[model samples]
Target: MTSPFDPTPLPPPECPAHASGGAPEPEVSEIGPGGLRRLYGPAHEKDPMGLYEKLRAEHGPVAPVLLNGDVPAWLVLGHSENLHMTRTPSLYSRDSRRWRMLQDGSLDMTNPLAPIFAYQPVCVFADGAEHERQRGAVTDSIARIDHRGVRRFINRFSNRLVNDFCESGQADLVSQFAEHLPMMVMCQIIGMPEEYDEELVQAAREMLKGSEKAIAANEHVMGALYRLVARRRAEPEEDFATWLVEHPAQFTDDEAAHHLRLVLIAAYETTANLIANVLRMVLTDPRFRAQLSGGHMTLPEAVEQTLWDEPPFTTILGRWAAGDSELGGQKIKAGDALIVGIAPANVDPVVRPEPSASMQGNRAHLAFSGGPHECPGQDIGRAIADTGVDALLMRLPDIQLSVEEDELRWRSTLMSRHLIELPVSFAPRPPQEITGPVIPERAGAAARDWQISSPRRPDPAASGTVPQPGPVPAAPRTAPPAATVPAQRRGSAPVRAWRTLVTWWRGY
Candidate 1:
């Protein structure tokens, strides 16, 4: 028997002679535990849609599968079935504590995949009245954000990131651009100093990878949030942290911090992946680019299409059977784990008859999930991705993939699929000069209270220079010297290849 984590691709299943002779095939139950397909492994990672189709043919919509430890779970595949499972919270609970494997110690807490499924005291794990309280706090606090101001931040940060690479003529969009833009914008929204953006991004990525470092990385993230919550308590600011702290639910300091961490990580991971996916599509698909350039399709439409086709998260872990119940014709016992197959359901033939056809203008994808636990901050993620992608394209209209599409690679975990690197080449250009205030004036006094810090200008009096009243002349545009560009910004093929290998080996 092959190991679940085996990198070797499995051969396609052959039709039995009995099937050609009109004999009935074996039932899924008779296949036994050992015969169940593993959700991990290189074959699934390379082509998950193929795996989903095979499972659908063999075991119907809710297929029995093994997780990392050969731990049994059900993967819900049908679009409607996924909706049914998520919508009926009474029948299927989000509380991981209710999972039977955890109860029986069959699922080791130290398992690499455990970090993702481990129960925490945040809104994501709560159900019923407790869920309402926590979810309300999160939603209400997010509602207080000025979205127009968010777009401004997205544009400013997007340009700043592009400026870093626009002078190099070659860049890896994944590491250099897509990865950092979301967190930088998020820092402004959460009232954290922009300088801490890199640390937060690193911590969030490490925590989600479910590697050995996940636990320590999670603690590091929580520690940052705890400090932020403490600061907000004394000095209330117009930010998500402050609003969450002031919610009527009156979360304890720890509870507030956990919720803040939840928002930060969720927004960061989804948006970062979304931006990368959209950029990859634009760079690789001539049809997509033509449509956008010709005004036949808009960037938001392209974003929506990517959400349907290549959602950031592939499989989410997961809802548990609240009691003995039936789902997609499967007998789900109390405490049985059921993972939501987000990517599979999106291409489900029942809803998407032509899977290869365009998904433009469709908003029914399970990318952000559905029902009571649906992502409350999905709109914010969309805004960041859409605005950020548009800004990059506007700045580098000639950008194209530096390698063949087939040469591109991805790193897949049970929970998400990530583009490892997206190398692209374009003509080097001068950086755009930003001339306005960082925060829009319409943001009001609350916005002014927590201004994004910037470098202090030298005082004329201290410099012993008298100011001239005439307007300063605009600087002449010139290509930045190659020596001035950062080594990583140059996007050296050998360096990028080594980095990609390290990232893949790390399971990120």
Candidate 2:
């Protein structure tokens, strides 16, 4: 078997600038163990976030870790700093050379898990207006998309899988339940035919498994897709392939293939890990499993907690500064690579509920990227997970972990974080066909509550004559300091102010 190593360089993560110049270690805190060592096989493969916390308690909260001498990166542990860094557009940037390297095709895909670079460049790699258009194409309905559509799709898919597994009394949740779910759904969403499903899924596995052979297979699929985009241009259909064919002026076939492949992997890879990670979360939290079984928590609620507690896409790769700049209290030079341990930031008590309670069931975090670059396909993911979990649980409420949770294995890949397999068994259920729309799971506006809200005033007891409670007033917003405001011309502010007043007056 190949050695377990990230395909990219593994520089000991940089500690904060405060710890720069061979300074003594800083502080770290301890949360419960995540069983990382036993799963990954090596101590170094253990989660840096966990180690960082240990280091922080031993040192100071603002810890510094030196890797490669000059690499100065710090752990932003507090909620305030994590939020400050994540939302900072001016100081911090999200760019990564890793994607560029992937497409460069220098690596040998001969290793089953080796990654072959792009079939072409995915559009997220592009910045500015071009990215907007590329992203906008699928985002058509975009934010307005009925997340319900996603739920329905997952419900259908999950039922099919559960019906197969629930009866077997045993199934490898990773391969049978989790991994296959995303790949098949990805194929459908990307408009690829079943003809390529098995091979594409197999290829996807290698990339995540980080096997050279799997990597090569993925490259083959990507290459075929590049060619297919051109061929499809001559013959259009109702899928993404046809969409690219029709929008010849907006993107070339090669570009479309490249972009689509990115979208597919983005959809598939994150999810493969998400399913595994969520399962791990459920297994670890007896209360959480009880919540699911007892219906105290709906699928949506459970997903929210898992997303915050242990999102699979722990770190997102981005380039520092597009070049480099001072960010998160560190002076980052241009051309530096950054691995934003985004998931860890999500779990910090500040951003999330105290990790302990949230571990029971709390706020959802941004496994998806935040702000402008946020995953446009989040609705699809939400829909898939909610539907899948709901259907599976409903079908087999008694399902239990076949292997001890600690004994389960985990592996990371070029694109995602995940488990090796999840074996589960339950009393069989009769196969049932899933048809029609799946109900939507409610996810709050952007996955977190930035401010507190008053309880919904309950409707007066239904006297049969009582009308429904009147619409409550919207919550007050946090106002910015006035001094920072630009001076407005004498009449302009009054005029605009009057217009706003009039609009509110009319609504009332």
Candidate 3:
């Protein structure tokens, strides 16, 4: 049995073009220095859309680009072209084994991009009947989820996360809220213990960054998934993991584990970034905020607009040419790799002539990609973002960005672009009392007594300033004493701290 992580190259799977003859060499002009552009670098990281515009101007919709390690591939930049590539799976394949570089052994498991493109047993890397089997299991399992229960979990986790910083009057929304909310909710849905979330979050994020640690991070995530699958198999539960294990597809332990890994990382990364992006737009753009708060634009509409303008995933490592074809006036050969330029395609001039115009109610954006391989968990991602953002805003209506818009930083990679921090300030508030089980019983097992750390009380003596009359000062007001939790329920250090803060809040 070969290890999935085996560094040894395997023989390229045979394709129609390979049987007819060898794939044609790309035209010299197209492969030349002037024709090819590298897709990862400071230039691209700083201004990917600007760089996409230049590439579109020079190379039309299907531009030749080099990924990390100077590996060559094509980037599909036109909206129509992107749809054509993804929709016509007969002409393009999702299987990375068909990739020319992978076939020739020029690309290997060690490449930073390998974490994305390396072949896995999961549906994302399958095609034909195999794809249908794996994808059906995922879709069926996802469809079984109770969305209302999902929203409850989202609300509960959102409140808990906000409580960690509400009393401080200042917090980094990225670190404190956006990053943790999605995974925490997902843990409940997937039947994983909440204690594993912090480690999973760190590993999932590191895996997507295409860094030297990406492979290791990916293994860590998979190892955890394997353990979860084993537990579920031994004693099944009514959660996503158990569903996959018992699906009619009869997935092996390895297959079930890989698919769980797929759903977890994909959902966590996309939703986390979506939450961050939506919040950033609300804080930075007064007009956008007015529309939402004024009831002119719904939160879902704002999320849609963000998807079009700044998708969570800027690019997805992507379809391989099934045979010779032409797209966006560029000739493609069998086995040529083509990345889906999601963000660029959403703004393609052909479909969206005025990129600045609103994208309300338009679900055509490729933010979630399209075709048979489109994201199965997109609705879940949207639900998490919408419910989480709405909860935060409702709890902290006075929230405002603590730093200037220009000062906010972003981390970009081949697959994603996300905020590094979203520092914000708001009137200090007390923690919401958890009156009932945060996790509804129907949402799997009864809620665990997970404890969260108490937020720091602002130091009034350190400020030493005269109070302003127009608005409340940054210093937190004295909170009331919190009720004590039963000793048996005081689970973790964080929760112990939270109880102390809650007790203090009750005295205010």
Candidate 4:
């Protein structure tokens, strides 16, 4: 039932101009894209991005490898393949079967009597209109980083966790702090009852660990979410849960519940890893620390750059091609997996030269993925993580890792770059309200959501123009399409009103 030159429609191409620009297509080892089982061990052990970089260095961006020893997977390191994957949904299916493995019966849950379930996704996993609907509500409900609010939450909870383990001073940052932050914030965003925060987090964490025991334990977590979905269905509130309930055009009860799980799961790892990784990276480089600690620089810019250059999504996402195709002139057969190399794609030398450039530019990093299939909740994801960083740095500015940086252990996974644990000495930042310490850095709607940068290239996947690793780009392409700003934006309305009132008072 398969033909090498079958009738499946090929994807629409971007400007093929850049395909001929810089370097010749990299070389690959496997005789054909189908012979990827040979490249499994190193690729699996080193994370997809690391393995992809090696292949790109030797083979090319379109290096084909095998997934889990049998299935063929394409390593789409080149801009064209990356963009093409996003654009052509017909050739790829995001419906991942790996998620179902979480439901294996060997694991047991706190709610042993609970119903068995399936792996669900937010709009990011959806195609066309359904995906769009989920995307719309998701884009709306992302909680912003309010310095005051996040500060309060971090202080109230983190201090307790630290205090509980202070004398010992060796609590796993993954469980104690990094994991707890996102769990708590997600609860807050969803308007879950405060009493259930710990209970809910425990369940969610169970699902997160992805083990047989953890899977079974996740029943409680999924059950609580199920109950909450029903409650919101009856009486919707203003929080994300309520919005999800009201957005009938976007998702159903089942869809919303799955999305809720996806959001929490997605939000949890990235936030934890970003914060913990920044600590590791900074601690590793004392000069960077001196620059940050000595007031020469704030960690935000450094944090943004580090995220761009060395993203936590070392092995974050994977895709399965729906049809046979050619990317960068390389063969890609149907039933092949295509994992996005966010870290490599970000630091491709072609994407951003300095890698440390501030966000004061266009959305440049593949760290968030691109095209319609891009991570819809990244803004919210960044906001939550940024809040944690802001909280940690602002509340515990002088915090130092308890162990030597060299002794720090890193975990090997297909998804992210993370330390096993980050034990630190917590110290609060000196309280001095500087003038405009945190500015939006936006000249327009899309003026770098994470940093302050301008748009330079419309199709960044292939566009040669890029910022020179600075805070802001000198020649960003142009403004993006006009999107209606949400009035419910956390601090946007208050900030505007407060400024206007002050100006009026001054005039009077």
TM-score each candidate: 0.81, 0.67, 0.80, 0.66
- Candidate 4 lands at a TM-score of 0.66
For model 3, what is the alpha-carbon lDDT of residue 9? 35
Q: For model 3, how does the per-residue alpha-carbon lDDT over 150-221 read when each residue is reduced to its tens digit?
A: 565576678888888899999999988998998888877887754355777787777776555667888887
Ten residues in sequence with the least summed lDDT for candidate 2 = 480-489
Clashes of each: 0, 40, 16, 23
For candidate 4, write residues 1-508 as lDDT tens digits.
2322222222122323113346663442333343343333444444545566667776566665543212344566775567777668777666554322222322222221122222245565567676777776666445222323333343344444444555553456666777677676666566564424566666665555544466665667667678878887775543567666654344677777877777777777777777676656665665455554444444455566667756767643466566666776677666555677676677665665564554433456676677776766665555555545543443343456688877776665555656678776643322333221122221223332222232231332454332222243232222211222111122223434433332232221
As a whole number from 0 to 100, the lDDT of residue 181 in candidate 4 is 71
Off by over 4 Å in 1: 1-33, 437-508
lDDT of each: 0.75, 0.51, 0.75, 0.53
Lowest-sum lDDT 10-residue window in model 1: 1-10
Q: What are the per-residue Cα lDDT tens digits for candidate 2 across 1-508?
A: 1111123432233425224356655432222122111112223244555654554354332233322222223434444454555565444444334333233432322322223222224555545566566666645423322343334455566776777666678888788878778876666545454434567777866655554375487677778677667656664433455454444135766667766777777777777677767766665667675654443555567777777765767655443344344544445544444444565566554555565664435444657856566787876775566556545654665667888878887664322456788887777657875553222222232211111122222332433221222323342333211111111112223434433432232221
Off by over 4 Å in 3: 1-35, 439-508
Residue 47 of model 1 has an lDDT of: 72
Question: Which model is ahead, 1 or 3, in terms of TM-score?
Answer: 1
